[model samples]
Target: MSNLLSGETSPYLLQHAGQPVHWFPWGPAALERARRDDRPILLSIGYSACHWCHVMAHESFDDEATAALMNRLFVNIKVDREERPDLDQIYQTAHQLLTRQGGGWPLTVFLAPDGTPFHSGTYYPPEARHGRPAWRDLLESVAAAWQSQRGAIDQQGEAVRQALARTTPQATASEPAAVLAALGGPLQAVAGAWLAQRHDREHGGFGGAPKFPHATDLAWLLERGVAEGDGDARDIALLTLTRMAQGGLQDQLGGGFFRYSVDERWQIPHFEKMLSDNGLLLGLYAEATALTGDPLHGRAVEDGAGWLMREMQAPEGGYLSSLDADVEGREGRHYVWTSEEVRAALTPLEWDLASAHWDLIAAPNFEARHWHLGVVRPTAQLAATFDQPQAAIDEIITTVRAKLLARREQRLPPGRDDKVLTSWNALAITGMVRAAGLAGRPDWLQSARRAADFIHDHLWIEHQGRHRLLATWKDGQARFDAYLDDHAFLIEAMLALLQADFRLEDLRFAQALADELLDGFEDTAQGGFFFTRHDHERLIHRTKTGRDQALPSGNASAAWALQRLGHLVSEPRYLRAAERTLLLFAAEVAHQPGAWSRLLQAAVEQQCPPALIVLRGPQAREWRDALLQRCLPHTLVLAPPDATTGLPAPLDHPLPAAGGTTAWVCSGTQCLPPVHRLDELLAGLAPAPAPPTGR
Candidate 1:
């Protein structure tokens, strides 16, 4: 029979509502029952978007015999990984520690009644496949161990609990200059150190195999090099990005990135695509494009967001969680293809063009009847491979894709996690707003606004004269208050919406959200914000940390969000909060500079902010564009009092520029005189001339 999770809002929980295995959503009752009955807890965590999660469910959860066995011995507690990343982290860590390896989705933790983990692993198959152990064997082994070693397991649990308690946040230096200097002063040196330790000198990327794009570190190094005029760092970062872009890991035709490459040259990838990864990568690409004016970066971002909008964004306006790696119950089966199928699909001329473009040359990765997948073609060679002109080839490919897509639809696709997660939706909002600003797509901006509205209307609640954000959305029920990542990323989204749409309500809301973050989420004694709020019903314990994972740690993200909010509101307190957050992790960041690239980026923001406030008349479109042209490199243009809600000006940051289509350049607190001509504004903004260009 189905359990309480059936009525839950989380799509992950609801996905299992029809399972023969009786499951209970995380609650006091399940914990209490486990304690009273002295049964081990079988805690399963994998979101709705996970393909393997669906596989394990269909193979095991739907089977009556497996369900009966599971229900009889273990008190099964299921959780949506998206909703409780902290809990996931804690248990996943325990699992990995016990197994002498790593852990991921469909995380199965075998824990004692008192909640100490004895064993854990991810996704056991019904029968042995790929040389892995079978699910039945694993279940029986765990059950036997739990029964025989109950006392030993409790002692191990007690020791782990102590280690967890020891890691909670305690205040560090109230100021963060030590943190900044510690991180910034040695970033290049540390990056070089890490590279010196193991960089693949010839192939690019960091590791030996199973490569993931270290996009943030590369972007930071690029930014730093540009900031310092150091060419070597820039070249290394650019080369890495270039190779990845050309590699098979990139969906050359479809326009989104795969999860990670299994080889050094990025030939094959784990096919899941996440919204958070796209958002951060898009923002990074946009920055890269602006810095270098490289057409590839610009086009890649264009294609990436295009795929995001077309494939992922849900009907409810917010984007979906992910696209699974597997389709038709086989990994990469749908995406891989046979040469004959291609030959049948196109003419001889088209075949010649398509074959070369798709790299049908090296050796067909697929079998004769069933095509095994291989690497994609190099980007530089693709334009020349197509028989038709580049534009025509693109058109033909689009048409061809339509036919393939239709045929693929006939085969059931991987399951989608439709639940709108606040953190991930926040990521999508930023990406959409950035696309709208850089690519000049107002429709994208509108799309961002729709998501913002969804969050505000559906997830936020006002009670006791305060605003609280919810974490999950399934049916009608919304439970579990927002975490640090939610508030942090959402605040960034709020500011982004204001920048893109110039909406005052959004600005107001962003500030209100920031206030909530500062008030309750802040680690007032310790300095950086805590991941979970103090009032969050006291879980086993709170975790205070920062690291870059698929997204980033809530603490680190909060640090950047606070820094951005500081710029938006001209608030020094937010700056201090950013400082404290980074400093809290100063030792770790000092040790591994490359890992904390996000924190370092925020550190760069602290040094110099490109903040500007513009003032002009209602009919100031021409004036605004002119100012924008001059300030394109770095500047935030603001509207005059007349253009805005005409909200009462604060004494601290009054609107200083003159009215009636005039422009002023301000740095920090200094405002220059107004000018009517774009040339004059450019001259005022430009540095003193040296010699003639034709010397």
Candidate 2:
């Protein structure tokens, strides 16, 4: 029989609706039942694409005896972590505090009736293995402890609460310029060295075994490369980008990247593809291509963006969340291919080149002697090996790849989590806008606009005279007050979208979102923004952090976007809030630059604000597009509508009043001489000038 999760919108939740376990979707009802019966709450948190989540479910949740024990001993509650990041964040942190280890998906927590977690761990096996307790035995022990030693569990819960309270950074207020000057040079040196130490120089990516694309770290390094002229920083970023593009993290038959590689060599991936990961990495590739002019980076951007449009986009335009790592209850079933399969799919000439170029002749890279493809040699090298022209070799490889992809499509595809998230879609919009502006692709720009329109129509909301945003939308329904990430990321996206194709409505929406962000998420007393909104449901703890993880932290994104938006809109409140946030996180950021990658990016911006270039008159688009082609990391291009007036004072320049198309480059209302020609504009922007004085 279906449980309460059957009515939920999250695909992760619905996947287990028919499980033997009596699952309760997190709500007042579950809390009430636990409190009424004085029973512990067995809270299980995971997402649709989480492979280990599936493993645990099949082993334990599907077993009738285990389900009966879980139902009898506790008020069972299952949460889709993607949908309830609030609960996930709190419990994940608590799990670490209790166990002194990192927490991951399928996080199992034993909580008291009042939602205080006393014990937690991730992914217990059905039977004892990996030096971990068996699931049923663990459950019985927890239940016994709850009944016999209630006071000890309550004390442990209280201790966790105290630890959580102490997690917030100590409040500090420092001048942005002074902080940047004192710490900026040292941080760049330390961060570069830290990344160098972790970098597998022989192969790409960081450390050994499991490898995640540390997009934030690469982005910060690239920013330093541009600002400080650090060649080594640029080299690191470029090499990582190139290796990841050629590695198995990329879908060799199709497009887009899998989540992360299991080996340090980047030869094997975990197989799940997340929208957030691709969106952030796409922007990285686009920017890297612009900086290095590497055709390989450009190709990566094209393939990744193509994957998004082809497989991830919903009919309504917003991008879907993820593609599961498994198909037919087996990991990599849809992606791996045998030697015979590849030979059958390609021509003789094609197979000869492809087998050598793609390492198909190497020992099997996957279980059961199947292969997950990885680039084995350069195209030129392959061409020479086969005594064929490079162009001919390229054509053969392309033709063979298309055939393989077509045959792969005939297999059962991975499950897709189709729910559209506002923050993730905002990231996607930024990626598309960056790629479109760089390549001058109107189609990509339109795709970005369509997604933005969907967000504005469905997610942007006004409730009780307060403008707000909903975090997730699916099946024509939008719900939940948006988190700080949602508002901050959308504001950032709107700015990028405006630069791609100037739109009056997008600018207006950005202003509204920024205002709402300041009012709802900013901590007036503490300075930094909270993860949850001011009116969000109260949890065990409210968090405000600036550290970058798999995704950039919400607080860091808010501060960064607000700083840029403030300069463009000339809003002192936004600027003040941003400055306060920088000061709030300054101590930690200064000491640990590696962990604070996104915040470091924001601090750099605070120290040296981007040149706000406003264009006007007949050839504004032409001027903007020309400037975009060049790598200008710290310049914002805007061509506001002619009808728009009474604009922000920082943007109230004489260029709009001047005759013909003209560009005015300014740093906070101090304008350089207006240039009417593209050549003059280029010359003026070629050198990175010193920052303007006295605000």
Candidate 3:
């Protein structure tokens, strides 16, 4: 009854193990079988958390008659997009080119034995509806076309390959200084103005319905606001953060954010909570809190961090991937509530506060029968209406939330994808470390350290006399060669961890990972890193892009991390690679600066390097923590423990004066005089006075 997927580790693949379609996990055997049998390959790519993936599996993959047709005509191969992003990237592009439409999960493709796709679609219905072909009918038609039009299909596949090759950005040849100048100053201003133009001034996020949190872009705006003294940019980012915190997109009862809002008002969300999204948001809100000292941003960071620690983190240390959008057979069933249920869970006073605050007294907002809570009234307004203090109103609301959350916990919850992905965990570790520094949460820092330790112990391995990383670890097994994201994000995490709590082993690990990035993933001739490693199995196309998708661009992250590390240890090779990456993508970024937020950040840093501070002696951590209390977006502070020894050249500063802490500050390669006092160090690092305006 079980298919080839039964032996797979991915939860998404395992879900299809018992289907009647006899699914084969993506591998050489399936391709060989397809070639030997002279049948097309039915490639189905989706993740565990995809609702449509489940729907399609139930309606089509599980049907005996449909399975029989598929078994007879094609070699059905199932793929977890999260696990094999290489395959997903190649085919998703092919799907878009073939259909002239964007791609989504549950991606279905018909490919030749050589692995070129001829046809593709997403989520076909069992019976024809909504102007789409029925699943079985489509299958038979595709099979017939495969037999009758083999030559035409092969020709189209070649065209598709050529088009994909064209998608890769051609390397630009420019001097490093010229590249920096082109991507600097006026370019930043233009990009900021562009972002301002597209900003949804009335509703908060950028452009219309289905609003995503674009955490990287918001971070860019926040950084620009601080570094360049751009008030409008700062306010735009702050307003968006505030709206998302108050909106239904964030779970008001619990603490995490949903995948995205389905409406312009941020009132309805897709309901799945992903680690990658929350990780980026955690650091973003933490930075906002440090910048403005806004309690709203602080609370958002606290709540989001709490949700991650409480619900998502595994006992093994690494965080899980995502929470499913559907509960049982219905979407958002676990999170939505009826008015009766709310009233039953709370006392009268609490009910009054909750109902007013969450707008339960009005018509149901969800399906006309249930309510998805959103902040409709401020606590101050509720307090005034009740003739009570704001503190008293807040207490009542908090009590009501606790009771409701407890009751909701009794309901069947959405399924969780428990795979521990190296890249995602790295993102979370970086978030936790930064949030810990900002919020002074030692527990969060320890949580981050545990995850880092898990990755180092489990996923990191020595291969062919060099250290390498595995992408996913699940069911006590780590498999698949690590991609660029895995190395870049983890290296960044290590840097953040070192700033928070110095660890010699972590520094060493970061260096090893960086080496792996250069040796395995980097394009020495072209400059940017490829998505796949040099020795990775040959796919239709190898992606080397600078655009930010759901996650930040790997090339951008790599360049940023390498530059920071290079300056920290005075490594020219690392610095040169970073410069080359910026030069390679400089033209593409200049043409559409707003679209490349992450890369633009790397460019900004490339133009003006971040301040690097080295502290030595007894009070080092004390001074570092003091500086961390204030928002220093462009500074890196490291305070090696008193016992730390065998330091790198740049970190090996002279011992402290009179056994007290001494801070050595540097901008790029130039170091300022060492300061013995914290106040003096802070004063030395203060922002330069702005030039006087014309009288």
Candidate 4:
């Protein structure tokens, strides 16, 4: 029988609709039921693509006995974390506070009737093992506790609520100039030092096992390397990029990256592919390719771009959320291979070269002796080993991969969560725009525009007599109030889209979002934007933070987009809001600069305003494209379709009454002499006298 979630649009919620457990979606009715029955609420939060979520569901949710226990003991409620990040954020934080441990998906919590959490945990096994209690036993114990220790649990819940309310960043007011100066020296220095220490010299990424892509850190370091002339930072960033491309975390047969690697070597990944991770990583790869001219980075951009377009794009235009890690009820089933399958797919000669190059000849690395392909040797080395030319080896390996991929496609594929999210789609747009500009691929730019158009048409709407953005859309229904991330990321995407292919409507939309951002989300007194809007549903806490987690924080992104938009149109109000945001989070950002790299990058941009290049004439598009080909981290390019009249400030300034395309480089109102040639314009925007050669 279908539960209440059968009617829901969230793929995660719908996945559990057929479970024997009588699950209720998180809402007033579920809370009211718990209160009416005097039962605790068993809130289970997980996303569709989470592998442990699947494991827990199969082991417990599908078991009739366990479901019976839950029905009798608690008012079972299910939530899709992706759908309700506000609820997830509060509960995840509460779990960490109550248990003194980090939190992950399949988050299980027992809540009071009023929705305050008293006990929290992550995945529990079906039977007692690994020192964790079985699900059924835990349910019985919790029910007994509800009756015997109700007062104590209520007290604990109140204490947690109070602790959550007290969580806020240290905020203070300062001039933009002062914040910029402090960021340039003390904050940047601390960040650099921390990155240097954290860098894995032998392997690439930071920390130990279970490494994340950490796209923000890589991006910030790249900017510092180019703009600030820091070679160590540059080297670390490049090394990490190269290693990740060669690792198994990146799909060897297909394109796109996995969620994270479970080992230091990046040889084994968690296998789920998220749209958010790929979008941010794609943007990084595009920027890195532009700056360093690394073939590997370019290949990553191409591969990831292909994967997103072919596999993730919805027919209507927006990108889907994620691809599950498991297939056929086994982890990494669709990705890993046995020796027999590899042997059967390739010719003798092709097999010899491919196995040597891809490490298929080695001992198996996964469960039941299956192998997860990771590069063990270069193709050049394989050629040397076989005494053949590199070209012959490459040809043979190419054919071998085609055969393998074709055969692999016959297997049952992992499930896809096809719901569209505004923030994630905006990230994809930004990535595609960068890749298109750097690679000179117009089709990629169009992909970005299509997604943007979809957002503008569907997600952006007039609500309550003001412009508003919706967070998620599915099956012709858009729900949930837009969070700070949705607005900030879309604004950033529009700015990128304008650079790739200018659109008047997109610019107008960006401005509208910025206006709504200030009006609905910003903390006028304290300065930074809150995660939720002013009229959002009341949760235990209303958070305003600057740290980058799995995704970049909304506050950091808003400050970034606002500053750029402010500079583009000579708008002091936008610039001031951005400045105040930086000052508000300055102390927290300074303390853990590495973790807060996104905010620090915004500070760098604020301190040294990027060049504003405005092109005017018949050949303006040509000049704009030429400048975009180069890596201009601190530059904004504006190429209006027609004559530059009635535009704001420097953009409104008339073009030289001449034949050739004329360009003006400005820092606010101060302008450089007009340049007609592309090289001359490039010289004007160059960050330093001599630039670092590509890797």
TM-score of 2: 0.96
Whole-model Cα lDDT of every candidate shown, in order: 0.69, 0.85, 0.88, 0.85
RMSD for each of the candidates: 4.4, 4.0, 3.3, 2.2
Scored by lDDT, model 4 comes in at: 0.85
What value of lDDT does candidate 3 attain over all alpha carbons?
0.88
Residue-level lDDT tens digits of model 2 in 120-222: 9999999999999999999999999999999998888888899999999877656667776655456767768888888887777778888889988888787
1 or 4, which is superior by lDDT? Answer: 4
Off by more than 4 A, model 3: 684-695
Clashing pairs in 4: none
Off by over 4 Å in 4: 173-177, 387-392, 643-646, 687-695
Residues 1-695, candidate 3, lDDT per residue (tens digit)?
Answer: 23698899999998888888878888888889889989999999999889899899988998899999889888999999998988998898899999999999899999999899999999999999998899999999999999999999989999999999998877765676876887866678888888899898877888888899988889899988887889999989988998898889999888989989999889999888999999999999998887776666777899899999999889999999999999887888998999999999888878888999999999998984999998888787887898998778877887887899999999998999999999999999999999998778899999998899999999998888767799999989999999999999999999999999998988998998999999999888888899999999988889888888889999999999999998887788898999888888888877877667787888877878889899998888888887776667678999988778888888888786578888888888788888889888877655422232210
* Candidate 4 lDDT tens digits, 1-695: 22688989999999999998889998888888999999999999999999999999999999998998888899999999888888888899899989999999899999989889888899999999998999899999999999999889988988998888767765665565776689856788789889889999888999889899898889888888887789998888888988898789898888899999999999999999999999999988887887776656777899899889989999899999999999978889999999889998888887787788778878888889899987788676887888988778767876887788889889999999998999999999999988888788898888888888998898887887876899999999888888989999999999998887776777778989999999899988878898899999777688887889988878989998999998877778888899888888887766667688888878877877877888888888888887777778778898877743456665665655756678888876677888878777776666322232322
Summed backbone clashes in each candidate are 5, 0, 0, 0
Model 4, residue 65: displacement in angstroms? 1.3
How would you encode candidate 1's per-residue C-alpha lDDT over 75-184 as one tens digit per residue? 89888888888788788767766777888889988877767788888998999888778888888988998888867877877777777777665656435565576565
Best by TM-score: 3
